[model samples]
Target: MAAMWLLRTLLPLAPFARRMRHGMTLGVRAIAIGADRRVLLVRHTYSPGWHLPGGGVDVGETAVEAARRELLEETNTRAIGPLELHGVFFNPPVGGRDHVVCFRVPRFEMGPLPAPTYEIAEVGAFLIDALPETVTPATHRRLQEVASGAAPDDCW
Candidate 1:
């Protein structure tokens, strides 16, 4: 945990590191839906808008594994069934060619909300028709695609 903190403290150097990288990076974003159809969203300490719970995929981790790990870490939730691949996006907003594998968990079990951490500030399950105004545009786009059965596109 201390090591993670140290890395996070040094995260401002990430842009420079990305510029020196030679290849695309992979990430995972999970849209965890409850039995009531509400979706989970999180507010990160470093980012401005609420986003789906997820993070960069670790070196040896599958996208699904990364999604599950991120869900637990951010929301204390566990996927009880298979995670569906919602889409893959070429996310250029992060200053690199970040390929994000998006997943949807239709069923999950929730524990008590996690205590505030250095990374996450808040988390909650929100209804599709009543999302908070602060949700990121990309998150809203993903939800619309899921709801309307629209073909998934490469952009995010």
Candidate 2:
């Protein structure tokens, strides 16, 4: 009975399965913040939770490039040189993996901050110790480590 049920499900997704089998998976994520102790976050359109401003890495792009690109695209803020490597995490119980690069960015003191774009609805500097309630669990954990000054030179 179980075998028959599995076959039924597979039969309906045969075309999708074929397409997926030919696809390559790759991704990058970032943890960006400023010296003011405010981190960059985006409120996702699909999910109610807030997360770092990053997405999948393009096929030919380096993880660092992807992280910087995502941050600029999502928040219009450019990071300075040297992004610290925090941790790399795998998307468990799901597909793909992530190389999470963290940066303790300096504030945009040269000029006014740019408005948030993309799926982000709003953007503002918030105290790291008093983050909003919309942050995701994993993100919250990262924030805690950042706040506690315990994020060592190792993977999380």
Candidate 3:
């Protein structure tokens, strides 16, 4: 009887503890680059600046799958494999438990892309050399390093 009561009490707290560990966490991004030097940007309906089309990696979803899902969800783009891990970023002094994994998608098809009905307000493709000024500082730095050949394939 005592053990049953203990298990019942602890089981309820188990999920709570797990959440606390992960934090009210989410993943997002500012930009995604594809081959042919094309950069993808999304104008958030709520936010003022333009950013890359990405969102939270759902529970039980892998990073690559999350990226692919976010890409299609936001811009209707098709990431047809050959996705490379670029880097993992941690956001601090902002929201809780936020982590973003950016990838260098090499082979993706810009399809009859649709305007995302979800959080995304607008989507556009741009040249890397002529990126917009609205990109976040972290994204800008990462892209610059990639452009200058300073960033490695796997940026942890």
- The C-alpha RMSD in Å for every predicted model, in order, reads 9.4, 7.2, 3.6
Tell me the spans in candidate 1 whose CA falls farther than 4 Å from its real position. Answer: 1-20
On TM-score, the stronger of 1 and 3 is 1
lDDT score, candidate 2: 0.65
Cα-based TM-score, every candidate: 0.84, 0.69, 0.78
lDDT of 1 by residue, 1-156 (tens): 999999998899888786678567888999887768799999999999999999999988899999999999999999888999999998997765788899989889899988789999999889987899999999999998898899888888
Model 2 lDDT-worst window of ten: 103-112
Each candidate's number of clashing pairs is 0, 0, 1
Better of 1 and 2 by TM-score: 1
The segments of candidate 3 whose C-alpha lies over 4 angstroms from its true place after superposition are 1-15, 21-35, 116-118, 152-156
Candidate 3 CA-lDDT value: 0.72
lDDT of 2 by residue, 1-156 (tens): 999999998899988887677554445556666666677777766667777767777878987788778777776777777676666654543443323445444433222445544566665556787788878877787777767777443332
Quantify all predictions' global Cα lDDT against the true fold: 0.90, 0.65, 0.72
User: What's the ranking of the predictions by TM-score, best on top?
Assistant: 1, 3, 2
Indicate the residue-level lDDT of 61 in model 1.
89
Worst 10 residues of 1 by lDDT: 16-25
